[model samples]
Target: MSSTPTTFDVRADFPILSQTVHGTPLVYLDSGATSQKPQVVLDAEVDFLTRANSAVHRGAHTLAGEATELFEDARATVSGFLGARPEQLVWTSGATFALNLVAYAIGNATAGRGPSRFALAPGDEIVVTETEHHANLIPWQELAARTGAVLRSIPVRDDGTLDTDAAASLIGERTRVVAFTHVSNVLGIVNPVAELVALARTAGALTVLDACQSAPHLPFDFDALGVDLAAFSGHKMLGPYGVGGLLGRSDVLDDLPPFLTGGSMVTTVTLDEAHFLAAPQKFEAGTQPVSQAIGLAAAARYLEGLGMDAVHDRERTLERRMMAGLREIEGVRILGDASGVERVGIASFDVEGVHAHDVGQFLDDRGVAVRVGHHCAKPLHARFGLTASVRASTSVFTTDDEIDVFLDALAGVRPFFGVGA
Candidate 1:
C-alpha cells in the first residue's frame, strides 16, 4: 500500500474500463494474457487502415509506399525499443511463431544449409526450464523428437525461482541450445537470465530467451543480457495482436536456414533454386502484418514516451500492493518466491476449499475478471502439485481501484460458493 503509484491515473486512458461487465464496472486484471489498448494505439491502427493501407516492400503505389515506410518505421521503433539494431528484428504472427521459427530454422541448419551450427546429434542436449510456457517448451520438444537429441530442463525451487544448482549440473558439454523465459507468464517469476546466460555461454551453447512477459513490464537490453536470440509479442504490451518480434544476433541468424519460404524473402528465385534476402528480410517471408506492425511501433513509442523506468516503477508498486492484498486473505496461498527481485504482479493463488474454476466463476459474476486454470504452463503446475490456480495480473493501465474491486469480489467468492467461511 505504501508503494502504490499516485502520480498518473492510468485508468483514464482505457475507455473500456468505464463499461459494466456483469452489473459492475469491468475490473480487468488479465494483462498477462493481453493488455488493453490505449487511445494512441487504437488510433494508430485506425489511421493505418483509414489513411494508409497497402502491401509493404512490394507495391510502388503511393499508399503502398506510405504503408511500407510506416511499417519499417515500426520495425525501427521496436528494434530500438529492445536495444537492438533495426536489422536484428524480424516480425512474426506472435511470440509463439517467433519461437517456432527459431526451433525450425535451427533444425534446418542441422539438416545442411550454412554452417549447420545447431545440428542435434543423438546425444546432444536442448536445455529449458520447468516453468516455461508451452510456446518455449514444445518447439524444442519437437526439435528433439525430430533429431535424436534429448531435451533437459532446469528444475524450479518451491519458491518458483530457477534452480541454479540444478542448472549448473544439467547444462553439460553436449548441450547445444539453452532457452528459457526472461519472466514466467504464470508465476511472474523473473528468471536470472544474466547468471543463466553466463552458464550457457560457458557450455558453448546457443541461447534463446522468451521475453513475452518481460518486455511489457520492464525494459530489456538483449545484448547486455547476452542472449543469442529473443522473442516477444505485441498483444501483451498494448499493441495490436498478430504482431510480435524475434530478435537474434546478426551472425547467428545468417547461419540458421529459413523455416518458411515464399514471396518477398528472396534475393533471386530460379525455377529450381533460390537465393535469400539479408537476415531480417530473409526471415519476414510474405507480405507482413503491415497495420499491426505500425500499431505495435506506436505502442513502443507510447511506452518509450512514458519511460520504461516509469512503467517498471508503476508495475512494481502494483505488484507489492497485490501481494499485500492476497496475503491478507485467508486460505490463499501465493505461489512464487515473493522475494521481490525475481517476481512481478502476475500472481496466482490456491484457495483451500474452492476449486479454481469455481473461484473464477464467482469473480466473473461480480465483474472481476481473472484468468483461471493451468494458464498454458501445465508442467509448472504439475511441479507445484496443482492442476490449476486463480491468476490476477496487472499492467500500467491498471489502477488501485480495479485491484480493490477484484479483491472485494475475491473475498466474497468462498462464502458465495459455500465452500469456506
Candidate 2:
C-alpha cells in the first residue's frame, strides 16, 4: 500500500484506457472478463489484413505463402511464450473451444474412435474442482453424460483453497481425467498445479488445465507445470478476440482424435472415409482465425518485452493494496481468504444487503468498470452462500490510483443504497 512507484508504467500502450466514461477517466478493473487491447495488437491484425490476407496452407500464391508463414510463425511465438513447441499448439476460437475440443475428443475415444488410453467406461470418473468456471465445468459434465462416466469435484475449503486431501481421495483408480483451473477466476487463488498433477499422474489420469486466468498474470510455462494439456484465451491476455490455443504434450496430442473434422485438417477424404493429419493440424479445421492469431502473437511479444516476472510483481503489489483497502470497509465481505495465499490482482466481494448489479451500476456511473455476477463461476458463488458478487481484476496497465478510485467508490456503496448507514 506504500506509494512506491509501480514496476510497470505502460498504461499508455492501451488506447482504450485513455478514454472517458461518464465524464471521468476510465478505470478498467474487469480484466478477468477481457483485457483491453493495446495499440500493437490492433496494428498487428490490421497489418496482416492489409498486406498478407490469404488462405493459409491452401495455395501456392505469394500472399498465401506469406500468410501461411506468418500464421505458423504466430503459432511458434505463442507456443514459445508458454514453454511449448509450435507442433504442440492447436488454434481455437477461444479457451471455451479449446476445452470442448479436449472433452469431445475424449468422448470420441470413449466411443471407440481413438487410442484406448482416452476411452472412458461407465462408472469412470472425471474430476474437477468446485471453483471451476462453467467453461471448464460444463464441458466435462456433458462429456460424462455422453460417456456414462461419473463427474466428481474437489471441494473448496472455507478459505477458498482447494482441499488437496479431497483431491487425493477423489482421484483414484477410477479417475480418467483430472481437470482444474490454474487460477480461480472468482477468488483469484493460484491453485497448486504441481501437487495436483503429481496426484493425477499417480492415478494414471490425464491432467487438463484451465489457464485462462493464469497465463496472463503468472510466469506461465505449461511444460514446466507438467499438465498433460492446457487451454488459454487471447482476449484475456491483451490480445484480440476470437482466438486462443490448446497446448499439450506431443504424445498426448498425437493420441487424441480430432474433435472437429473437415477441410484443412484432412490428408485424404473419400466419399465414405477420411484420414486426418497430425496433432495440431488435425484439430484445426476449416479457415483459422488468421488476423486474430497474428494479433495474439504480437500480444505475446509485448508481454515478453515487459517480462512476466515483473508483471507478476507489479500485480501482487496492486492486489495487496486492493485487498487491504477492501477489508477496512464495513459491510464488505471478500469472497475468499485473502490472507497468506498467492493470488493475482483480483478481489471479489459482497456488500451486505446490496445486490451486486446495483453496486456495478454505482461504480459504472463513476467510470470505475468492474465485473459483477457469478463470473461464469456459479458453483463457486454457491459455495460462498451467495448468487453473485462484484469482482475487480487488474492487468499490467492498471494503476494504483485506479485501485484507490475503485476502493473509494466502493466505500460508499452501502451508504448510497441506504443500508448499513
List runs of model 2 lying over 4 Å from the truth.
1-6
**lDDT of model 2 at residue 417?**
91
Please tell me which predicted candidate would have the highest TM-score against the true structure.
Answer: 2
Best by lDDT: 2
Ten consecutive residues with minimal summed lDDT in candidate 1?
Answer: 1-10
Count of clashing residue pairs in every prediction: 0, 0
Residues 217-262, candidate 2: write the lDDT tens digits: 9889988999999999999999999999999999999999999988
Write down the lDDT of every candidate, Cα atoms only.
0.88, 0.95
Question: Which stretches in model 1 have alpha-carbon errors above 4 Å?
Answer: 1-6
lDDT of 1 by residue, 1-421 (tens): 2254534566677777788977877888988988998888889999999998898987689998998899889999999998999889999999999999999988887787656567778889999999999999999999999888999999998888889999999998999999999999988988889888889999999999999999998878877888999999999988999999899999987777888999989989889999999889888888799889989988898888878877887777778778888888888888874575656669998988999999998898888888999999999999988999999998887887777888877877777767665
TM-score of each: 0.97, 0.98
